[model samples]
Target: MDLNWYWYIGLGVLGGGVVGWVINAAVQKARKSSAEVLINKMREEASKEAEHIQREAKVTAKSEILKLREECEHELKERRREQQNVEKRLSQREEALERKNDSLDGKLKNLERQEKEIELLRERLNNRENELQQSISKQIDELERVAQLDRETARQMLLEKLKNEVKNESGLLVRDLLEEAKQKAEKESRRILTYAIQRYASDCTYERTTATIPLPNDEMKGRIIGREGRNIRALEAATGVNILIDDTPEAVVISCFDPVRKEVARQLMERLIGDGRIHPTRIEELAKKIAKEVEDDVYSAGESAVLETGIQGVSPQVIKLLGRLKFRYSFSQNVLQHSLETAYFMGIIAAELGLDEQKAKRIGLFHDIGKAVDHEVEGSHAQIGADILRKHNEAKDVIQAVAAHHGEVEPVSLYDVLINACDTLSASRPGARSETTELYLKRLEQLESIAHDFAGVESCFALQAGREVRVVVTPEKISEGEAQMLAKDICQRIEKEMNYPGQIKVTIIRETRSVEYAK
Candidate 1:
């Protein structure tokens, strides 16, 4: 019974084992099928997604193509438009060229015709000269036979007698006419000049361009110099002037090319020295205040000048510019005072000449107005003055006179000439101007030397205080055109070789004299 029980147990165990293996295999198979189905379903989904992706890509590519096509089409259109424009311009240029060619041809034809006409006229003149020569020869032969002398002797005797008589009469006539006219002109000019000078005698005032500030002590210079020179630098930066604090004991020197800056710095220095508190901020503040004060004083000065001159209806801008001349100097002579003197002289001379006195005075007052802004403006004072006058709506005559005062423009009226004379008179007066004699003589010599460099120049004079240079040229050597060219060359040389203050007038005088003595 134990054996049979063992056998059955063994078989049961084996059967159970087989059954478990089969179950496990079936489970594995079932799982594998489910996994395959899942994988297939995933593949289908993936395929669908890929198709969707492909569709999106195609759509994107098509849109991109459309954009690119539009862009290309726009670019092509632009190119076509540009080509059309270029062609149009080229055609227009061609037409213009054709028109120019036609005009040139017409001009050429006209010139040819004129040349032919000139040739014909020349031929006719030659023929007429031949006929006249024949007639003269026949008359001469007849005269010789009648006089019973050779042609040479008879002609010489007659010519000598006629020359003697004509020479004496012509010389006397020319001498008398020239002497009378010269005397009258001299007398009138002297009278006018004397009357004008007598009527308007002005006080001579000269200005020195020195800006030396006297400090109380040398210790004060250290304060002005500040820590590491910030004080001096601030003063320089504020006033646009150099504050030179060298070994100058108890004195500070200010240097600048601009007079306005020098004056401003001078006032600032005085105030700072009085205040005894020197700092950068204080410097800037004081500089501004002093600048404003100076400006006001300048304007007042201009107003005072205008009132003194009795000028009416003056433009505020012009008056302001005129006031700036208070600090300006020409050859150490105060420009403002010089202008006042010039105005007075102009008025007096105008009265004597029976001219408009107010107008004359107006021109004189504004003649040097350009000097006020010349530092800030380009061009000569005369041209700048004219432009300023034009901007101010000044009278055309007055503007012309101001421009011509320095011969920058041709004189259009008597005022222009009068301004020159009065300007010279004012400047040339004794003690009116103080120039370095050595430097003045050197400049004049240099100017003359510059003119002498040009060929055909007989002599050159620096007149009008070196404002004008008169060059006398040999008429035989320099023609009229060459004289003008020589003047220009000399002027160019002067401009290149030397530094001058004002515009120099180069007058080229070319004259010939035919002189004879009657015996």
Candidate 2:
């Protein structure tokens, strides 16, 4: 039992020793681990601080670099500005120097030219003085020898001679100029008139105020005369025409001073005869229908003329008036035909004169349009036509041409002059106008009597169908100047006393016959 107790005690002691050693070692290990943890923590803190310091240094250095760069840029910019200012000043100074140099050069050139001019003047003055002295001495000697007169007398004689010569020469020059101008004017007038006449081929026809309507049978005349002349009276009243149902076989005669009325009457008679109607009502109805038809025909005629002449923008009223000319007659010449001839003449002349040909044709067409209503209107045809054109908003030039075509107003354009000439030409052509034998003979006799009435007129002959009168004057009675005056006087007298279609030319001939026997 004792051995077992001792063994138990030893085991206990040994166990206690082991436990203490383990507890010590465990404590040592814990201490070592905590120490290592502290050192590692300190190392991590040092690394964080070093990194933060490095970042601050970098920020500070970057700020310093940015500030230095800005300063350097500022200095560089200032230096560049200074350099630019230096360059600008230098350029300005250079330009100023150039301007001063140019001014000096100009002044020097002026001085040089002035000096040269003064030198030349001095030399020329000296030469001229010597020449004047020589010339004066020579002129005195020569004048005394040649003229045998004093200086004053020679001067007066020379002045008188020059004055006489100038006077004679100037008179001759004036006379020659006047003659040339007169000849040129005459030639141009003749050329323009002749050229217009030559270019246009006018188909002239005699227009009659009376129209004869053919009847289908003798019964038609009675129908036209109608029940106690009621039909004839109705037509005459409705159309303002005189319907004469004479004993003529199968025909009716319609007469009126107004051609439009006559035309309407003629058409009415034809329709009534064709329809075999003999009542006044039918006569009136047909008259109205024919009148409207005549109006349409008139418009058609006017339009045809406008188109043929290539004229545009004519008012409807003016065109209607132009159409009335279709049936009108002027001294046996168809007025429309006369107008066409005048228009063509105007176009030809206007083209030659480099004017607007279409405008000229328009003026010609409207020139005689007033004649259509002249019998009804109070004013002259030219003035009335001008008023019509003005009302229609025609151009100023066209209106003036219309007003001045007949010399009622002063011509304002070449077109107006051409229209007047064309009008005269159309009226004056051969076979253009017809006059009775009695009237024609009377006109010729009147022309001759007027020429004979003038003093110094020995014999007068009418030529060119009374267009010209040649008066032979005695040379002893009338001088050349008197002959011209006598011609003008006769022309004026004829114009005032006579009513003629065309101008009459008065020519006075004076002959001084020097008859000597040839040995």
Candidate 3:
């Protein structure tokens, strides 16, 4: 049963195989169609994509072309603008160069014109010089022919006439100049003198020879006289003055011709009397103490004088010497005070005249420095002061001023003249100096005797306290020129004989007046 069934199954299997083959072929065919359809759709899609890609590439190419075109246009526009700026700058340079060229041409033309003008003027001057030379030659020839003398002689005569005329003119001119100079000098002298006197009015105090020291009683004199006049002798020796012990009851007299010594003695005596110890040792001690006090006072006085004069940087030694002058009396006036007053006057006048006030004050203040040491040192105060100033390395102008103040040397600077002016003002002021009756009479007699010895007989009178001497000369005996000559001779005699502080104005008054009186 299984075999027959196998055969039937095999037959069915063969049929089924045939059917299955057909169906399989159909399915395969269907699968092949479906693949072909898919391939076709993919091809169609690819063609569309390729076309879109090509359009997009065309659009990109167009955009690139537009961008390149815009860049090219921008570059062209910038290049055009740069070219315009360059052209405008070149035009400006060209205009500047043209103006410079025009200026140079104008300058050259002006220079040429100036040169031509200078040449024409030179030509004219040369022609004039030639004409002048010709005229001078002709005139010389004519003068030589007219005069019998040679050319040189005629020229000399003509020169003589011209010289004479010129001399007369010059003489007149000189006379006018002399008159003007005299007037100016007089005006200036009066102004300077007036200013100097008015500015310095320092009071004068005379140091008397007899110094008074009031004692408590007469018993103090015995104590002052010490054990055997030993105290008085020691005091006199120490002070360089005379100590007069007398019966004048309550006062002791210190006497000396030298005012400084007298002052020192008086001060020492007063100190000793006040101390009430009158032994020789005590007298010596008091003398030294008083001397030191006097020295300190002198130094203070000197420093005060310098400060009052407004001078600075003076040497201490000079200051000390200046202080010593406070005790010195010259012609009854305090010498140091007088010097300070003179310095003030000089400084004021110097400031007014626009001169060096420091230099003028320095000279005036130091002018009397010699007076401090004059008692110890021998020489003219002016010369001594000059030497001291030189020792201190003073400026030459200052030294010259010191030396020339008293006419010891020729005054070289305005400061020298100013010092002399100050000195004169100080000495010549009223009540500044005094003379004894004997000395005044002697000076007057001497002056009159000297004037009487002159060639022109004249009566002389000492006027203004011997400051001036007026001589009345006989006009009949002395000619006008002789009167001037006689006055000069008398002045010379006075200068040679007398020792005076200032200049004496010499006035020779010669009047020729004819008088007819009807009665």
Candidate 4:
């Protein structure tokens, strides 16, 4: 039984092994079939994808080729249009050049024709000139033969006649022109001057410088002397002035070159006399006090002048110098008052003439500033005033006006001339100045002598206190025109020879008297 069972088990084991092997073989075959089917499907999908890619590439290449072709066509069109425009512009420029060439040719031909015509005309003129020259020669020969005089003699006679005629004509012309000019200028100037003077008027009052101080008695003079002239010396040293204690009877004369110093000394002497304390120390104290007061008065006067004139920017040094004029005098007229008067006159005249009124007033006020220091400086007052103004940085016009105010320098502008006129007006007004009888008579004589120096003057008289000179001329010797000329000549000589204030009027009187013997 064991054997049968073992044999059956072995057979059964072999059968199972064969069945397992067959199952393995079948499974391998089935897996191989599925894998083959999968590979075929993958191949089919890959081939479809490759065909789609090839179609897309062909379509994209076609579109890109069309775009490139379109762009090339556009660029070619643009190039063709630009070439057409260039050809059109070149043709237009060629036509313009041809037209210009034709015009230039025509102009050149016209110029050639004109040049030829001018040459022909020049030849004709030359022929005519030659014929005229021959005719003139014949006329000259005939004239010399007819007159029975040489050419030179006839020419000289004609020349003399022509010279006489020309002299008369020129004299008449000059006289007419001079009369017309004088009438116009005199009318305008007279109108302006009369208007200016009428606008501003001052009194005929004059101020005189007082240098002598009086005391109560002679004892006051001795007390002022004070112990071997200690007080006088101290007073002089303090005031920088000279004290003249002469036998003038209870009076002392204070002399100083500086007007301000002289004024201070005068005040100190008066104060010392009034105080009755005439000693060295007292004098020193009084001098300082009076000097300070006078200085203040100077500044006040100067400031008042500046304010009255309505001018600005005057330097302090200039104002101080101007104030010194308060104690200054010219021909017994107070200089400060004269300056103010002059300034007013200048302003009025300048306004009438349409000039700078303020500048004119400034020039007038500072015109005579040199007189304040004329004693201390070596020069004319006008020159010194100019120097002072220049040093103080005044305007060039103002300095020039001041310098030329007295005619010391040539006038550079209208202001300079106006200052002279205004200054003369202030000084030469009625009772503005005074002189001794001797000087008055001397001036009159000088005026008469100057008139007599001219020919045809029978008698000359200085009337109006030397302000005017009337000349009587012989009518037979001096004609009407001659009298006018004589008057001018006399005036010129007087102006050149003499120095006097204001202007002098010269009147030439031509009169003829017929003497009859009725008896």
User: Largest TM-score belongs to which candidate?
Assistant: 4
Q: Write the per-residue lDDT of candidate 4 for residues 302-341, one digit (tens) a residue.
A: 9989998999998888888889999999889999999999
lDDT of 3 at 40: 100
Q: Please, what are the lDDT tens digits per residue for candidate 3 over residues 100-124?
A: 9999999999999999999999999
lDDT of 4: 0.89
RMSD of 4: 9.7
- Local distance difference test, candidate 1: 0.88
Model 3 misplaced stretches (Cα beyond 4 Å): 1-180, 204-219, 237-240, 246-262, 501-519
> Which clashing pairs does model 2 show?
none
- Runs in model 4 deviating more than 4 A are 1-176, 514-519
Q: Which segments of model 1 are wrong by more than 4 Å? A: 1-180, 443-519
Steric clashes per prediction: 0, 0, 0, 0
Q: Candidates' TM-scores?
A: 0.56, 0.61, 0.60, 0.68
Model 2 ranges with Cα > 4 A deviation: 1-179, 189-191, 212-223, 245-253, 274-276, 512-519
Q: What pairs collide in candidate 3?
A: none
Tell how far residue 231 is off in model 1, in angstroms.
Answer: 0.7
Candidate 4, residue 226: lDDT: 84
Error of 4 at 102 (Å): 29
Q: Candidate 2, residues 1-519: lDDT per residue as tens digits?
A: 689999999999999999999999999999999999999999999999999999999999999999999999999999999999999999999999999999999999999999999999999999999999999999899979997888888799899878756655665565467579989988987897777777786665555555888888887777667678787787788899777778888877777778788888777776776677668787777778888989999999998998888888888898898999998887888888888888888898888788999888988888888888887888998998888888889889989998998777878778888888789889878789888989988999999999999778899999987889999999887766566667767988897788788688788888999998988
